[model samples]
Target: MSETDRPRPRRRRPFRKAVGLAVLLAVIGYFLVQRASNSGPAYCTASATGAGTAGAGTVQTYEMTHEQAANAATIAAVGISKGLPDRAVTIALATAMQESALRNLDHGDRDSLGLFQQRPSQGWGTPQQIMDPVYSAGIFYDRLAEIKGYTRLPLTVAAQKVQLSGFPQAYAKHEPDAAVLTAAFGENGIPASLACSGPAPAAGDPEKVRAELARAFGKEAREALGAGRAGAAAGRSKPAGTVSEAEVGLRLKEGGGPAEARRGRAMAHWAVARSKELGIVRVSYDGSSWVAGRDGGAWRGKGGEGGRKGGAGDPHDAAPGEVRIFVARATAH
Candidate 1:
């Protein structure tokens, strides 16, 4: 009975375990690739700040430290003028202001760049393309425009279409910022000021700016951006003087390296974010401030050092300002 009942103990098939493990690994790899291809998740605050006013059935505002409004407005204007609808502009502004405060940060979700924090590896564009505000914004709009119904798409949906962000819903909060920019820069809407409040443009070493761009792109964070765009490894090199507008634009286009662009964009947005309190009627970069009757705008030069009227101290200090969003005055319709 023992001999018959003990008929060959069933042999354990270790290969089955091996096959199971292999399948598990393959699934994990698939998801990893998917996340990597999607440009990763957005770093955002869960709560809302009253900085921006609600409109068009939306009740959210891009959460920014006191300094992101100007940058958000500028980014929104550029996006809208580039043919992106108000919704797209709002998503882009919120993403930038929240991720890098509308700065063309050379950093982000693993080698993401520019105002929208697009990653070159994720097919947003090259690091250079992602860094250039126009190019970057254009790329974002290109993606956004492709959405089936982007204009009517919710802020998060439109942004997710363009960004492929892991946190797909994060873009909802920036609607207010986009709306504000729309009202200010729309066809005949009131103009809200935009400016920079960081270290005044000086004849300092330009290389430093380059480095900052890299850092903002998440280089400082040393994020693991697998197979980044070819030229993305190189850090931005500042020339021996104050960076020119062309240079700034170029750096933004180049992307990758240190995130100097992010820092610059941050300062610019911070100024815009605080414009009302600072009484900043207009803001300009390596280029010009706004002029009502001039085709060519004006760049604030060394002579414009004290350009910030309300005694804005070091921009990095995160000082509070007097102005708040006057929604009624700044609305478009």
Candidate 2:
């Protein structure tokens, strides 16, 4: 062929470089978005003193989104209501992280669904029921309880029995974070260990908050949140569902000693975990308080240090072993 007519070598290098640059930028953008989604919007943390668990004077903390924290608190509360102990909460949480990253998903492998990916074909529950985090967590605990000495079993082994995941070892990797979250939600968890901060939504649902509390914590919650409110209302009691938008009080049984105290605190943490959803602006338990949009949502001790104005419903308003939840008003702009 004539030199001029000969086919010129294809210019591949420039094409390859352009493609490489696009791929690199795409990867970088993906990671930046993931980081923002994880750390932005709202966040919650569970911190434990390492004096015995890790090391003296060292603090170990696990941070997760407000959604993860709320789901975790529900798991812990349901387990506690069932008298299932903290180990059960840890196992349930690790399994959820492995299966759905602690999100109550509507779809999963085969008929699997919800937090633990329980399948309806395996008799876990209907999709609608399993989609309820409380229901899914309860079902998981029921199955876990049937296993002999499940509390003593290795975390992965116990979770595998419930999940039967293809990758049994995947559950192990989440155990550390799960355990930290469990410690924050359990009765013996560090005081004020669980707190959440998210954008102040325009409004919140007090009835939904009451309903969720009752469902997660069982009849005890009903009595504390319902009967207590009724008694306080005197002759002007309204229907149970008519909780005020601006406030919800959880008067845990007047007294049961230290365990009762911790239970109240755990409930308080639950309120904080769900602050963004329930429109909980402030939560006070024992003496410490947590206020969303303030102090990075950290819990504060008495004396208004948490940024609450001295007024009718201050954080210190809560009596011993009592928890007060102040919600967002419907009129909030």
Measured by TM-score, the strongest candidate is 2
Q: Please, what are the lDDT tens digits per residue for candidate 1 over residues 1-333? A: 777787796667788889999999999988655433323221111122222454434433223332344444445535544544455655666666556666667666668777777777778777876666656766666666777877776677767666667787766665665555444333222323232222122222223333333332333212211221111112234444423221121222235322233333333333334333333323333332321112111223322223345423322121121111111011122
Q: 1-333, model 2: which lDDT tens digit per residue?
A: 789999889999999999999999999988656444333357888876641245545666788887888898888889888877778888888888888887888887888888888888899888899999999999899999999999888998998887777899888888877777776776474432887755544457777788888999998788788644421211233444443346678777765665566567668889989887777777777667776776766777774537555533442357765777777654422
**Model 1: ten consecutive residues of lowest lDDT:** 322-331
Q: For each candidate, what TM-score against the reference? A: 0.41, 0.78
The global C-alpha lDDT for each of the candidates, from Candidate 1 onward, is 0.42, 0.75
State how far residue 5 of model 2 sits from its true place (Å). Answer: 48
lDDT, model 2, position 171: 85
Model 1 ranges off by over 4 Å? 1-74, 187-333
- lDDT for position 8 in model 1: 90
Per-residue lDDT of 59 in model 1: 35
